[model samples]
Target: MWKSGAACSATRVGVATIITTVFGMALADALIKQSSTAMTLWQIYVLRSALVLPILLVMARGRMNTGRYGWIALRSLALVLMYLGIYAAIPWLELSVVAAALYTSPLFIAGLSAIVLREPITSRHWLGILIGFAGVLLIVRPAASGFKPLALVPVGAAFLYAVAAVITRAKCSDMPTRALAVWLNLSLLVTGLAASLYLSRTGVGAGFDYPFLFGAWRPMSGRDGWVIVVLACLMIGISLGLARAYQSPRPQVIATFDYSFLIFATFWGFVFFGDIPDRLTLLGMGLIMLAGVIVLTAGTPEPTRLEKAKVARDQPLVPCRVKTRTRPQRTDTSPSNR
Candidate 1:
């Protein structure tokens, strides 16, 4: 009874943590969208990463997994690319649209699992993937009057994010969550520094005036600086929340709540940017969320052959009895004594 109660409490904590994670991520994106108007993406990345590093370092102390450094680096690079794509698209696209597009990662994950992880892909997963892509089409509205090539940016981000997630599960599953967070932020810092150097040397073109993507570094306003600080804090919260949520014994339970990020993203979009989704956009968002929920709640993956072997090896051995001709001799002896 006590064990059951503890499990229930842990589940509740995991759910709450995941919900908070969604909100924190949405808020961070909103803050980035707001601040991007005044600062370069590289600058924001560099500053926020720099600010968040010390905190993650302290948290990750004694938790680092050096054995999986290669996988960690791969995952971090994928994450950096994901961020670069989404941040570039955010300025040109509506917040909700970018978010909905990015949320397609679950579909990508499903497909990738089949290819890379050798996980069976059920028909339901395929249906979910189709519906999810249909949602992307609705959002992108390709060849329609409202189509924008920039809409593809978030899709790219989603693909990279899916790759990162797959690597997390497949290669770095044993690594501590704090170690993953530390390496992710560190990678962001390195990417930011590299981008800043390249941009500083090349200079911004006249046609690309958006400081967030193309513009070179300049003095950040006090307001923008504060916003970056808030963004950094939000990133920390997001990292911790996601790490905890996914690391839970029953990750599917926590993952089902991840779709709420779209809701929060939509809310923040309207409140901060005064951007409202039209019927088509809303439809797309709904379909994407539904597909994500379906995919996440379908079922957990079965243990791999290696994992099954490991489980079997860890189990205690039981002694076996042998029946032999001696049993008959003992019975005969007992009968004579009687």
Candidate 2:
């Protein structure tokens, strides 16, 4: 009874942690979008990490996963590209649109895992894939009179993120999670420095309107600096919170609440930018969420009658594994799946 009570408590904690983490993530997205005029993408990448990387380093103990550095770099590059797509679209797309589009990542992971990992996918998983894309089409609205190209950016980002997930599973499965995060932040820092250098040297975006992407380094106001600090906090908060949440005995519960980011994104969008997703966008979000749940449960097996009989006769505990397209899987339970 005590064990069951503890499990219930742990589940509650996981649920709360995941929801809180995603809320912070959504707020970070909204903040980044709001601060676009003040801070460029590269600047935020550099400055934000400059602040948070130190603490993450202390936590990770400066481990580099040296043996798998090549694979780690590849994964980090994929994720950096994914973030670039996500943040670049923020200035142009609605927050909810970006969230929903990026949330299509589960579908991409499902498809990619089948192709790359050679994992057998269940029929329900395929149905999930189809339903997820249907949601994408509704959100993208390619045939509509007012389709925007930026709407596709998050979808592309989602695919890139899926690629990173596949790499982590196939190659970096043994790397410590915090250590991997260290490299990711380091990659972001290096990329930011390189881009800032090139832009500053060539004046490539001189007098252009894409201040968020192309603008060179500019002096930071106090408010701008604080935004950077807040964004960094959000980044670290998300990482730590996810780590804590997934550590819960009830990962299935944590996984279900993970989609709360979409709702939180929509909420922050409404509050910060007065951005409201229309009916189709909301529908797309719902389909994507439902598809994710279906995909998450796709490969879980029901115990056979013999196993059930044994359980009843002996009253023995049974163990089961649930697979997510790239979400942890049977042996891997890294939070980076999303």
Candidate 3:
């Protein structure tokens, strides 16, 4: 049993981690939206990435995983594109609408797991999947009159983010968290640098670039610049907290808390962007949450302790592997020996 103090600390960390993750992400999105007005999406990514890279570098010393570095780099690159897509859409999309659209990622995970993890999906799972898709359609409202061509941005982003999550779960499970964090920041840095350079050449210098990055790193600016700097730092902290949360807690539990992001997003949308979600948006969000809960609870139970021990003893834990290998080899070798 955990001591009282330890338990309290754990609870605090869990709550703080969730709150920070949600709030920081919302603020970052808002900042990117605000920055997008004055700067290109690439410039915002570069500045935000530049703000976090040095700190990640210092922390990753002695923790880097050379063997798994490639996967880490790939994951980070995917994230760069993911954020670029999400943030770029912000200038044209409602904050609540974008948040609702991205939340459809869990549905993709549920579907992808059938192929990638070989898990048996049940009938209820299908119901949840359909419900989730309906929710996305409601949020997107393509049939409505006001739909713009760029409204599909969030859908495209959701697909890429889903793929990124699957890759993180399957391929990068063993990657060191610190090393993964470092690689993410580094990859963002490279993308940001290239983007900043392009914006400079295209004569978008102040209009599409940060007013300061063109030689003068800090010029006369309003509080907005400071807000961006602070929000960028908070984004790093929240991301680190999320990495730790995923590392420590059982994934199901952490995933449940991830639902809190929707709540926080709505709250921040109102507070920062004056986005008051309509009844339809609330209903759609509720359905999406229901789908995620269904998926989480439907996960297959892990084997019992006895079954685990049996597998550890090198016994035939699953009969299919034995039959496949033994019968094939016996038929081929039996003829040769005879």
RMSD, one per candidate, in order? 5.0, 15.3, 11.0
* Alpha-carbon TM-score of each model against the true structure: 0.88, 0.86, 0.78
In model 2, how large is the Cα lDDT of residue 295? 86
Better of 2 and 3 by TM-score: 2
- List clashing residue pairs in candidate 2: none
TM-score of 1: 0.88
What does candidate 2's lDDT look like per residue over 1-338, in tens digits? 99999999999989999999999999999999998888899999999989889989998884654577889989999999999999999999999999999988878888898899977688899899999989999999999999999899999999999999899889987777888888889999999999999999999888687988999887899999889999898888887898789889977668778999999999999999998899999999999999888887787456679978886999756787787676554866689863
Q: Write the per-residue lDDT of candidate 1 for residues 19-64, one digit (tens) a residue.
A: 9999989888888888776888888889999999999999889887
Look at candidate 3 and tell me the lDDT of residue 252.
Answer: 62
Candidate 1 or 3, higher TM-score?
1
- Candidate numbers sorted by lDDT from highest down: 2, 1, 3
Summed over model 1, clashes come to: 0
> Top model by TM-score, which number?
1
- RMSD versus native structure for model 2: 15.3
**What would the per-residue lDDT of candidate 3 be over residues 171-196, giving only the tens digit for each residue?**
88777777777777677778777766
